[model samples]
Target chain A: MSINAYLAVGLGSAMGSVLRYSVSLASMVMLGTHFPWGTLLVNVLGSCLIGWLAATASRAPHGKLAHWQPLLVAGFCGGFTTFSLFSLETLHLAQQGSMGLALLYGIGSLPLCVFSAWMGERLAFSHPPAA
Target chain B: MGHGITSVLLVALGGALGGIGRFAISNAMAHALGKAFPWGTLCVNASGALLAGWLLGVYGVANTQSLWLFAVAGLLGGYTTVSSFSLQTLELWQRGQAIRAALNMVATLLLGIAMTALGWWLAQG
Candidate 1:
């Protein structure tokens, strides 16, 4: 990849990570850390956004929004969503014997995030006809 | 060095390094392991989880806001990803590899957590 590409990914990831931090803190305040609603919210939202961006990017003729694909989708959305913390938090819950909550979070994450992405893709195709 | 700008800059710099490192490692892994399975992302996420757990366990959430922003939120956050994992799983299922997709999902969740706990426990000791 070019230096520009690296810079784009880096900058986008930085912004995304910061947003994630804010969301996590807010979620903790609102929902409590009993469950990781923070990471889940961002993960689901980020997946959906990346899906929308990916679909939009794919439909664009040629490389019309080439730079945008990496900056927004790969860098921003990817950095915004995290699987590691989700896993760790779930483990913490389970290890502490909160098996129900752990299972709920684990089972809920995959389908919800995947469906959100699907919805995003559908929304992208719904309006503003693909180029 | 107030909270607003310094925090943002720290996270940004850490994220940039994390993102770059993730790209390099993933590329290297793909080169070595092939793209049939997403071993690269799996490794990255697992290692990121481990480090994050260790950092939190060792630091203990007192006066490490900047460090937390840089390491946990920025570095590990950028290093690991959920969107790619979800998309890859979807793609695998779409390609008729249902079993592989399921295995990937289960293994990632199980292993990621296991490694994180391991790291936390190690740091505690």
Candidate 2:
């Protein structure tokens, strides 16, 4: 809404993107690109964080934390988790005739991300209500 | 460029630029296309995927960690999104637009992946 909001999103997105890169690089080193574990990890983690923040904000008494939505939800999570590259990677796998792997990846991502977010929301609200 | 503090900074800067670009493009598309469907997000995701594929193909993945950070990780990553997509799909389902919700989810995934492969294929030539 304001210039400040834009700045916050931009800065948060920058940090999130950097973190995504680091995680992906680390995953590649530790595991291997045989399965796109890096993107999966980031996407699920970002979903979980966003869900937690959104749920927490909804239960908060004040709207103060709402202001950070753009920065955390729209910018950070959005930047950290990428649908584009996920799709791209799936396509690559399919093109390589690893149709089984591609199908596994495709079917796996949506449910995993959605469930992660749901878990996050539940986790945040599962605790006793804040006084 | 090697992976170091400078590379991180470069990725950060690229991410900033990409995030701003995504915000602007999505807003502009929403203004033009109306808000019935998330055309803005779809466009962003699809294009970002294509670009990621092409960039990786062009740059190669062996010795270009910095380039990967700046382009694929920072720029394309910032430009694309999954959170918004998930939120929107949930919203649509909640609102009883189950069909559109399914359409959005399926189409974006299918098209995004297809386009990425196309970009990668093109880059080979």
Candidate 3:
């Protein structure tokens, strides 16, 4: 990839990270941090978006939007949904003696995210083919 | 500049660098290990979580909000991705590699949390 590709990914990551930070702050104020609702929300949303974008791209390999894959799919969605934080949060909960909650969190997030991505892919594929 | 703006700028800068780093590492991993499995993402997420946990132990989340924002929330967040993991798992399942897909999901979650805990423990001592 060229330097331009790096630049696009970086810019997209910056934007996505900022959005994630904002949502985390908001979630803290509204829902409290006892559970990482913010991370879950972003992960689910990002998974869906990535799935949709990936499906769309597969359908149109040489479409005009192909160039945006690095920025949107890899950078934006990747930055927006963080596995590290999820892991750290789970560890924190376990350390705090909330083993059950931690177990629930660790076990729960995967299926939710996968299902969301599948739903997004289904949505994309279900649409009528472009002319 | 306002405090909030400064914080955001720090996060943006960290995120940009982290994203580039992730992209480079991912590309290298894919080339070396092949894309049959998402070893790239798994490595990134596990290492990122370990780093985040170490930082938390060193800085203490309550004390260094700014540093935490830049390093953990921005850098690690940008480096480690759940979206790619999810999409990859779905693809694996679609390809009829249900066992591999399940293995990827379970391994990632388990390894990530375990690595984080290990990092925290190491940092504490």
Candidate 4:
């Protein structure tokens, strides 16, 4: 990565992280602590946005937007979601064709996603994520 | 930060910082790991869940005021992600990477929860 790359990621990380915080906080307040509405909402929203960005990037494929490409792609999406890793490791298993591992993991994630949020709230709402 | 202009500015700044941080980290992970699976995404989500839990637990006993909220919840949590988690799982399904898809979903979800619990447990202790 060049200096531009570093700057782009830096800029994107700051904005993405802060925006996520604000929205999620608002969601928590507007919603409730019983569930992890904030995380759920942020995760979903961020994913959709990234999907759109990816599509857009593919289509145009040029300009300052392109310059902002990595920033948005690696930086924003990176900031916004860990989807890359999810895709990577899962795919790694897929290539190996470890049906059992893959299938079991996929099924297990359902509760996990909920539980993570639940625990987050439980920690925060019930106890909190420590100082 | 007040609920007025200052709060708005603070919110913006925090979002900007978090956004950039997320982008930077994800990029680094993607590069370091490679482009086959999504080690980047998993790590980010896992870390975020862990940190959020830790911070929340601490805030309960100590101070996680609005500013702290802006920093930790907004900045770090925001910089990290969960959305990518959902999307990637869906993408795997689309590509017919069934086993990997399933594993991806399960591992992230289960691991994420476990991590959150671990973080909380550590904080509480």
Candidate 5:
């Protein structure tokens, strides 16, 4: 990777980590630490954003957007979307008389996300008829 | 063990980078292939899982304090994502691709655990 790439990843990672922590803390305080909304929010939002970027940005030729994708998707998204928080949340939910909720959350989250991914790809891959 | 300023900070930092990382990978793949499936995400999550399994097991077995904290807890834990995988599988099943989805789940869990064991053995050896 080039220096620019490294810099992009590092900077995005730093920011992403900070956001993950902040949201988790906030969620823990308000929603309670038992389950992790922070990870859920981050993953769900990350999927949507990634889907949108896939749909909209790929059609255009590479230029400024080329560099931007790494910073946002690879760096920030990679850093932000974590499985650890997912495990913690599920454990907490199970412990808190919400075993079913935890299971559903764990089971349902990724597939729901796949739909978003597919939709994004479909939208992006498809083009308007010679407008 | 829970609720520390440092841990919280790490999560946020990890999240931002992870989010961006996903964006970069998926978008790039989408652009290159001109396809409708999420090859990027699968690549990212699967690769991340392999690396994490290796990393987590190495540190866990070796009992290396530094590795345990930095590599295992901070890096690996921050890297791989069960959430994305879970969400992906659900979508597949919902779309009536139940077989593929089930296989994906089973494969991920089994292979991930096996890789973790491999890493542990390698580290201990």
Candidate 6:
């Protein structure tokens, strides 16, 4: 409810959104737009990052990473991975009579993202490399 | 200022505003509905998808690339998040609420796509 929280989220979101835009443009150039590889990539990466950050923050409640949860987890991850675009892309695919692809895209994304998040959490909980 | 820079600035501005709006709405929904099921994220994603569909329907993708970048990619993208959805589903499963987790995933995907289709239909008519 504080102004600081809003500012943190806003700034983080700007950075994340810009990164997403760059990735989308790059993916479009490299892979073409037949499939939304860019959105899927971002969503998977963002979910993994959020899972790691959330797990790390939870492990140490008052740690430095916890302090930046609003910015990094909520703002950056939220802005970087978009559900709206995913939904629209699926809809467009279906509209274009690519129903199988639409169904696959819509149904496939959830489990993949969740698995990525789970893997990220496992990575966080795993012991750090010998230092 | 070049076209690329201008587009980036627009996206940044839209993203910032959209993120703030999402934060406010999420907090409000959590407060109002309690945090048992992540109703906030579902609401945000569904609504954002609807808006994105409507915008695309109204403007068409080929004609307004800049507006698409600003509003759909920036604003709606910032507003609607798969990461939160994925994390929440994983948490639900970890907590042994498998049914709730499944429900959340199905509800979000169905509602989002349905809303997007509805928005497009409405815009067309």
State what share of the real interface contacts each candidate retains.
0.61, 0.61, 0.78, 0.39, 0.33, 0.82
Decide which is better by lDDT, 1 or 6. Answer: 6
Number of the predicted model whose DockQ against the real structure is largest: 6
Task: Output the TM-score of candidate 5.
Answer: 0.58
Q: Clash pairs of candidate 3?
A: none
The CA lDDT at B67 in model 6 is 81
Candidate number achieving the greatest lDDT relative to the actual structure = 6
In the range A7-105, model 2's lDDT, one tens digit per residue, is 877888899888987898799899997888988999899888887778788888466667677788778887888886687678768777999999999
Worst 10 residues of 1 chain B by lDDT: B55-64
Q: CAPRI verdict on model 4?
A: incorrect
Weakest 10 consecutive residues of candidate 4 chain B by summed lDDT = B55-64
Per-residue lDDT, model 4, residue B76, is 56
Instruction: Give the alpha carbon lDDT tens digit for every residue of B1-125 in model 4.
Output: 34545554554565557655555566688888885677776777677667655655566422235665465544655455655555556566557786877787667767765665566568888
| Residue-wise C-alpha lDDT for candidate 4, range A1-131, written one tens digit per residue | 57677677656655665555466557668985433445445555555565555444445566455557656755565454432223223333444677676555445434354334333323333332222
lDDT of candidate 1 at residue A14, scale 0 to 100: 83
Q: Please report how far candidate 2 places residue A83 from its true position, in Å.
A: 2.1
Per-residue lDDT of candidate 6, residues A6-66 (tens digit):
9999999888888998898889989998888999999999999998988888888888888
TM-score of each: 0.90, 0.88, 0.96, 0.65, 0.58, 0.96
Stretches of candidate 2 above 4 Å error? A128-131, B62-65
lDDT of 3: 0.88
Taking the tens digit of each residue's C-alpha lDDT, what string does model 3 give over B15-121?
Answer: 88788888888989999999999999999988998998898688766523788878887898999999999999999999999999999999998899888988888
Residue pairs of candidate 1 with colliding backbone atoms? none
How good is the docking of model 2, by CAPRI class? Answer: medium
* Local distance difference test scores for all models: 0.80, 0.80, 0.88, 0.55, 0.56, 0.89
Q: How accurate is candidate 2 locally (lDDT)?
A: 0.80
Compose the digit string of candidate 1's lDDT tens values, residues B25-81: 777888999998888888988899899778757885432488887887788888898
Give every candidate's TM-score on chain A.
0.92, 0.93, 0.93, 0.58, 0.76, 0.94
lDDT of 6 at A38: 94
Compute the DockQ of candidate 5.
0.25
> For model 5, how does the per-residue alpha-carbon lDDT over B19-113 read when each residue is reduced to its tens digit?
54555665677788754344565566555555554554444323224434344334544455544454456556667888878777656544544
The candidate, 3 or 5, that scores higher on TM-score is 3
Report the C-alpha displacement of residue B120, candidate 4, in angstroms.
Answer: 1.2
lDDT agreement of model 1 with the native? 0.80
